[model samples]
Target: MQEITTIGLDIAKSVFQVHGIDAFGAVIVRRQLRRSQVLPFFRKLSGCVIGIEACATAHHWARELEKVGHEVRLMPPRYVKPYVKRNKNDAADAEAICEAVQRPTMRFVPIKSPEQQSVLMLHRTRQLFIRQRTALINAIRAHLAEFGIVAGIGRHGVEKLLDLITRGEDERIPPAAHACLMALAAQLAMVKRQILEADRRLLAWRRTSKTSKRLEAIPGVGPLIATALVASIPDPNVFRSGRDLSAWIGLVPKQSSTGGKERLGSITKAGNRYLRSLLVVGALSVIRRAKQLGYTRHPWLVRLMERRSVKIAAIALANKIARIAWAMMAHNESYRTPLPASA
Candidate 1:
């Protein structure tokens, strides 16, 4: 081996591909490694730069590679795509990853710690359960509507339907249909319990994390949003500014500039979808509260709401909130309430 200086690894469930080059850009190694052989193979090589595409199991592999004295850089798969010469294959993808890591301008994803990954996993699982709950609720509603038994929308309405199913007193419901609705009702109850448990775990995590606790002080930020934000962003300083963080969360407008003419459309919605949606939902809550009070602490939001529709204002508020969060995290400071317009 001619002193392999850089390596690109394409990882999968069972097999992995490796491509390596010397300092002089000459091929040093091109091979495949089984799942069992990956760590042992890297252990034999001297410390060198290794590139891997950010994907499933990428973080685990990166953590493993780093433990064996190798420098690992994780590149977004999209950024590596341009470097691929021809047909897509594990080998080509590995080569592209190898090439992309050496680029001075290429952006790399920050390696998340196991703790962060765990928190994100909790969030994902909770989201899954919530979706299941919604599906169950909708199914029950549709089934009941078939029997001319309909309830209003919301938790109370869902509970009413559940009550009907539990009592088995709705004469309109067919016996067979009643049995099916009972099954769904049981699932809905289980899912609700699971959601509450998830919320409890998240709350416990938020209590232990000083960052999450501090983040909760910000308007519209609850324990769930605070914990998710902290876990999703491993290092706030990776972003150059609050705007960058907001943009990364896909809260900023999409641009289609040409010939020095600036044209912007809807938000790019390119980055972490979960975080973006959370921020937007939080913003909407703030807007709703402000409307109820007929005044807001932040005059800028009040002015913006006066000029734009509620939805647009919510987006702008979400963008601002993201920026505020970035600043707080990067600087290790609490959120400062903006002065009232009168002041």
Candidate 2:
């Protein structure tokens, strides 16, 4: 009977390391292959179990290797990090990945499909352009403030500042500074245009996506948020329950317990920062809007608001929303707002 050996892949930009052992855990193959050579090498080899650290290009390679009849598993970076010996190198890292994959407690990241990746690309690019636009606005404001000009933070503020600069409406602003401001304003406008274009395209894509549509059915979750969530959460079943979804999004408190004493602190903040941030923002909007209109007797929200600050209430709402999202996605159903517990 042929041994069901395992192989570890340490991925890099140009070079890669492959570590494998025989039935007795003896190093049978320690090979180096270039990026172009990696796929072809695997194509020629017999089907076996392969492990790789979850990072850039891991998903693509995992999908490709799986297509070739190999069982590919991707372990999170932290899981593989523990197995790395004193001196970390490609070969040792590859070996560690292999060892980690065999652990009973090991957790794996689901390989994202190309469509999921495409949606994520849109979100990443939009974030980058927004950041650049903000920087440009700040730079313009700082440069002009040398002559006593102040610009607020926002895309709208960019337009207003540009109008002020080009129109020479400000007595404190000089002509030379206005010239520099105009160029900076142009850059800001360009970035805004790029962001808008990307957002439009992303929304269009989200509109047709079944997952995004289901997510969007929930309140406070628009197309952008829905699409981003679907992309980030490729496999919802990995989470045991809806609460785990909130915890995964950093919406749950951190726990520190010792000697039969337990204390819950601030959020773990361990998962995707972008998704957490979006949820928090959405929660805040819901609360603010609710106040101006009318508040429902949601027991959790009532207790949270009375005992804690509005910020805490907002976070609780976000946590609930995260759980709701998980339930909807995991169960493959639309949002179901269960009745609030007794107040």
Candidate 3:
């Protein structure tokens, strides 16, 4: 029933802390609420600005709070970290979030929509399953190698191994080991099927999503790049330019500055790991095909390949592709490839 000027919320799985202050910067309210009671408490409060760290589940909370007529700002966790006092606790974090949100220089995270999260989740689940399947395949291959059977070390190799195991070609194999191998092979097949299904869902979602469709129009951006870009970036404005987007995705080089001197290193390797990886893979494929299909005769590819190894060229190209993808998203235009100069 009180007029709260600003509120800092420290959200957790079960309990939450609400730190409230008034116009003159006086602490007016400090209360702890259970998960079930948190929303009702906010609904009853006078509409005010709510500050929360841009953490897990923050967007969902941000949208929920907005519906109650309160403005929500989600601060990046790194920015909020410097504000925490010596004694770090819920209340301290809540208070720190309170101070961080009011700064004009602070960059707040753009709240992701539920649909965005859903599409991203498919990618994440597929990544997890792929990792598991890879580990299992390696183990199966290693175990079989002890008995003079070897998997040649590729997806196709794993597939063939599974076929050999399923057909029971090795009757001399121990029953227990055969059982384990068969089980692993079956699970690996399941995971492959799931990954394919996820790809199907992503492709379907891309068909209906304008942003993904536009991104996919770019030369190298297939389902992976299209989905990764849309899912990872919640706001295009957060990046001042496409270069900034690429840099944020760790495509840009790291730098160190001293007195009148500057040195640059390899890519910073910060930000969304999955998106960076997808971009790298897409770019590598493009580079490989360009070499094999004689597209290397193209000026850019020729000059790039001449300057560095194919692997390095692929990474640089990937970096440029990421920037271009951002530009496409920000400008709401289809990709415009560069044309050769007039004769």
Q: Which one wins on lDDT?
A: 1
Question: By TM-score, is 1 or 3 better?
Answer: 1
How many backbone clashes are present in model 3?
0
Residue 291, candidate 1: Cα error in Å is: 0.7
Which digits, one per residue and each the tens of the lDDT, describe model 2 over residues 1-343? 3454889999999999999876678787888999999889888778888999889899999999999889999887987899998788898898898899888888778889998999899999999998997788778877877877666767676667788877878878767777777888778888989999998999799878888898877767888789988999899998899887787778899999999998999888877889999988888888787777767735466567878999888888888888888888898898766686655
True-structure RMSD, every candidate: 1.2, 2.3, 2.0
Off by over 4 Å in 3: 295-298, 341-343
Enumerate residue pairs that collide in model 1.
none
**Per-residue C-alpha lDDT of model 1 across residues 1-343, encoded as one tens digit per residue:** 5898999999999999999999999988999999999999999999999999889999999999999999999887888999999998999999999899999998888899999999999999999999999899999999889889999999999888899899998789989998898899888889999999999898888888999988888988998899999999989988999999998889999999999999999998988999999999999999899888876576788888778899999899899889999999999999788776565
Tens digit of per-residue lDDT, candidate 3, span 91-169: 9999998888878898777888998899889889989988987788888898888778876767788777778899887
Write down the lDDT that model 3 would get.
Answer: 0.85
lDDT order of candidates, best first?
1, 3, 2
Worst 10 contiguous positions by lDDT, candidate 2: 294-303
